[model samples]
Target: MEIQYLGHSAFKIKINNTLLITDPFLSDDPDLGIKFPKIEARIVTVSHNHHDHNGVAAVSGNPFIIRTPGEYEVSGINIFGYATFHDEKEGKERGRNTIYLIEGEKMNVCHLGDLGHVLENELVEMLGEVDVLLIPVGGTYTLDAVKATEVVRQIEPKIVIPMHYFHPKFKFKLNPVENFVKEMGVGVPEKTDKLKLSKDKLPQETKLVIMEAS
Candidate 1:
């Protein structure tokens, strides 16, 4: 399986012939001075109803869309959406959020869409095994660097990819990725364009990967 980051919280994942995209934030924003590239996917998953995280219409190919908590199978990929909150106040602050676990090619790629609070023990057990984690490290609307690092410890994924943080082009009041890197006590790794992984060759210890938006 291969994963490509598309600025902010959007990501495109390719598993064999199937294409999957999460939180398609494709609209051009003057504040950010950025535009998403044209991409097609068989499946799209939105964590919440936020405009920034739910741009399904921008994606082509008439993809199957999942936005709620449920179990679904698309193109032989098993997807489980777990109910989560967008804020620590139990949705009083932001609203409900969905954390999706995409299972394909014998690996589990978990995307925490705008997750605002840390996971409880039960929620972590529900996620089971996560090979790759796509998480939001930006503070204001989601988990900050410290909390994000805490969550990473909870999930204990082999590959950790931080997202939704501050970028010069993002124009959001959020913490920088450097904060998270610091909390993890590791020097920043060189940013890569994409991440390719196979179950057999996954790292034995947790690894932090910084990805350049494609």
Candidate 2:
């Protein structure tokens, strides 16, 4: 399977002949100036109902949307959404968020949608071993660099991808990606437009993978 970042928290994951997109941003957002490309997918998973994460209309082909926590299987892809919060206040401040565990072939990928706090022991145990972890590194509305690094340390994913941070088209004043790299004690990350990997090819230890938004 391959994963491609499409700006903000949105990502396109391709498994076999099926395509899955996560967190499509609405066009009404002022920070959005780039065009939402003509994209189609068989499935879509939303972390929350925020304007930046629930633009189902923007995705064509009438894909199945997964937002709540449960077990779902489609096109040989297994999805498990674990309930979480977008703020330390436990959704009182910013509502609930969903942590998606997408299993394809023998690989498991976890997407922490706008997670606002560090993981507890129980949540860490629930996550198990993650081959790839897509996490939020921006502050204010989600986990900042420090908390994101804490989550990374707990989960110990083979591949880590940062999301929901400051970009050229993003108007939010969240911290830069470099801060997350510094927090992780890793060298400057290499940027790529897309990534393809398999179970046998995973790194022996955790590593950060920076993906450029399309």
Candidate 3:
């Protein structure tokens, strides 16, 4: 599998012969002024109704989109969407959010879209074991660094990729990636513009990878 960060919470994942994109925040991002390159995908997944996570216009005209809550299968990929709240409490303000679990290539990838706070027990149980977890660490609209770390511990994914934080172009009040990386306090985190992975080469332990937005 190969992964490319498209800025903000958007990511492109290539698993087997399929391309899966999540939370496409291209074109609409005011800070970066970055326009997304035209790309084709077999499937596109949007976690919620937020503009950052649901840039339907960024996708090619012919791609298949999964937006509602349910189980769907297409081109050998199995996707399960569970309804969850975006804010800390119930949908008092931010309204509903969907967490997606995609199964394919002998791995399960989870994208926590604009997750505002810690998850509940039942939501955690539904997620099960995540091989690759794409999470939001930007606090204003999602979990802060401290809270994100706790979520990572609960999910226990083999690979954790932080997203939704402040960038050069993102106009938000949230802290930058430094906060999260500083808290990690381990070896130097691998910083790359893109990531390539395969089911046969899955890492044994949870690894935090930081990728540059394209």
| Clashing pairs counted in every model | 0, 0, 3
Q: Write the per-residue lDDT of candidate 1 for residues 1-214, one digit (tens) a residue.
A: 9999988889999998899999987566554556777988999999999877887887999999999999999989999999999999999999999999999999999999999999999999989989999999989999999999999999999999999999877666888889999998867664799898899999998899999989
Candidate 2: misplaced stretches above 4 Å? none
Report every candidate's CA lDDT.
0.91, 0.89, 0.83
Instruction: Give per-model TM-scores.
Output: 0.97, 0.96, 0.93
lDDT of each residue in 54-170, candidate 3, tens digit only: 777788857789987899998889999988778887778798888899998788989888888788888888889899999888787778899988899889898889988886655
lDDT of 1 at 211: 94
| Candidate that scores best on lDDT | 1
Query: Whole-model lDDT for model 2 versus the true structure?
Result: 0.89
Give the lowest summed-lDDT range of ten residues in model 2.
27-36
Question: lDDT tens digits, residues 88-201, model 2?
Answer: 998999999999999996888999999998888998898788999999998989999999999898899999999988877777688888899999988877689989888898
| Candidate 3: residue 48 Cα off by (Å) | 1.3
